[model samples]
Target: MDVDLPYELQLVTDLRGHEERAWQIAWNPVEPLLASCSADKSVRLYNYQPSNESLKFSHIHSIPTGHTKTVRSLAWSPSGKTLATGSFDSNVGIWEREGGHDGDEEAADWECMTLLEGHETECKSVAYSSSGTLLASCSRDKTVWVWEVHPDSDFECMGVLMEHTQDVKCVAWHPSEEILASASYDDTIKLYIDDPSEDWFCFSTLTGHKSTVWALAWSPKGSYLASSSDDLTIKIWKRVAEHKWECALELKGHERSIYSISWGKGKTGEESLGWLASTGGDGKINVWDIREPPESSTGRVLSHKLIATLSSAHDVSDVNSISWCPREGFEDLLATAGDDGSVRVWKVVPSH
Candidate 1:
């Protein structure tokens, strides 16, 4: 029998004014707000909240000076105090949260802090490490740059990760590890680990996807990794003995290219093997239950079962990105941004 799963989707907000596709969306780690960047050359912030048994979002601010061309990717710092965005103009922008001092009734304000210029082509992705110590960005220029974050110093370029032969689409940091993973149109995922000398080097390469690998994420526990591709499949991988990673399982359900992937935290105080959620060009979101490898298995081996499937979640356009909100109490909430110029939120309920 087919497992029947359902999702309660509510149109949280109609983020308009983007003449082109919306590429990326990110949620603040400390506040109920989201930042979205689009091909319209603008970035917008929304005050998001749950209301009337649904998600409600309203636009509060917009940044037009951050990028001269299309803004493709956005990320928030672990402290939730800073925002970073990447654009087709070959630049990255850092935004700082201002206001909110003692007895200040005004809402927290945001301003562009600095602009990073290095990439020669469009920058595809930007991410802040969990410790907020490093900012990483990947670009069509076929290189990834790591920046050292200092409150007193402007964003300084620390090192460059140069390996991919094609446009790098995404970069993700391992939750608690000193490892960074990046996916590229070159059909490869490169893992960079810091050496004893405090310099980062490419430790390993994961190659299995037949097409472009667009998105990648590390599980919350930092035990497993997930990558989605234009090949229309999601692959789960695990670190094996001696700093090597092997493909464990392959999930094949999406009818189109998978654009984004995210891992969900387990129940309260529970050690989660974790769940993988992905969005695709087919306008669907699928959640996979990542299982632990069998005891007798050698190397990295993971098994996964399709836990839930959401069809037409973004019926109006292609769902470009999916993220699980990072609030301490709202682990079941999922947010999606799409080409329809809207961001939607869904509540995930497990099968009882």
Candidate 2:
């Protein structure tokens, strides 16, 4: 940890269960659960209790995703009833509780209800829309697929977008809209929206990063986007028009490839929009407080201040992913996945 920072990242607990590299960690949108996918071909779910003073996490269950390869990514539905797992087996698995419960019980068994197989190569990422009515996935096949979520865990592919020239690394949906953003090995980010009358199509392509764009996060209000890249920098893009988004700010601090980033509500409330947390091969976690510039500022100005830095967060191993807790009263909490096969929970505590 950097002593000069105004905030400190206090390690709450270490979750040891994955037998191989933990690739990604995601907090349940509506439950006290955090799900992590691993190269061991399994996904582990942990239950957490958060309080003002401290936080506690316990391993609850492990689901053998049966993907025959590494589970690269996993995401929870907005209702926290369904889990989607993407794998190198070129398939996406949709999971639900054994009895269709709402995750009220930690011991409830889970089963894979559906397998959506269309990608010809490895599936890299999966995400659910804000409304929970749609799912988006990307693959090494250089395609992005939108799936319509139906009753009884049924999924229908709505579109197969072939925009990225290389493997798509990640996919993220706007916090409050149907728009989707995808980062890729092609070193670009593509924004897609549905015509409703026709199908989903790319409306904008953001190209500023010199290397592969690894991850993307949207502001709380969905007005801006933050992207991390293998170029070792994070860029903030602002929507200047109905369909145009331009790079408004560039942040450089990481010493290696930036793998993942997340934006969530911050301590400063709505005025600051949120804080951005990023981590990657540098084994460091950096948190920034991003604020919109004053109304008089020109060029859609924005400002950011680094509030905290956690060096060697994974003890010499690369940190693969970082995610912010989205639940009320737990906004200060964060979870990170490391190549050392451990999941660590942390809280951003004020130094003062």
TM-score per model over all chains: 0.90, 0.97
lDDT of 1 by residue, 236-340 (tens): 887776588888788898899999999977342353476678997999888776767566777455666666777887775899999988787777777788888
**Where does model 1 exceed 4 Å of error?**
1-3, 6-17, 50-55, 100-108, 266-272, 293-301, 350-352
Relative to the true structure, candidate 2 reaches a TM of 0.97
Instruction: Identify the leading candidate in terms of TM-score.
Output: 2
Question: Candidate 2 residues 1-352, lDDT tens each?
Answer: 3677789898999998899999999899888889999999999998876456676777888998899999999999999889999999999999988852564566588899999999999999999999999999999999999999999988999999999999999999999999999999999999999997999999999999999999999998999999999999999999999889999899988999999999989787777979999999999999999999888878466889999998999999999999999998888889999999999999899876
**Residue 114's C-alpha lDDT in candidate 1?**
88
What's the count of clashing pairs in each model shown?
A: 0, 0
* Candidate 2 global lDDT: 0.93
- The CA lDDT of each predicted structure is 0.81, 0.93
Native-to-model Cα distance after best TM-score fit, residue 212 in candidate 1, in Å: 0.6
Report the error of model 2 at residue 295, Å: 1.7
Give the Cα-based TM-score of candidate 1 against the true structure: 0.90
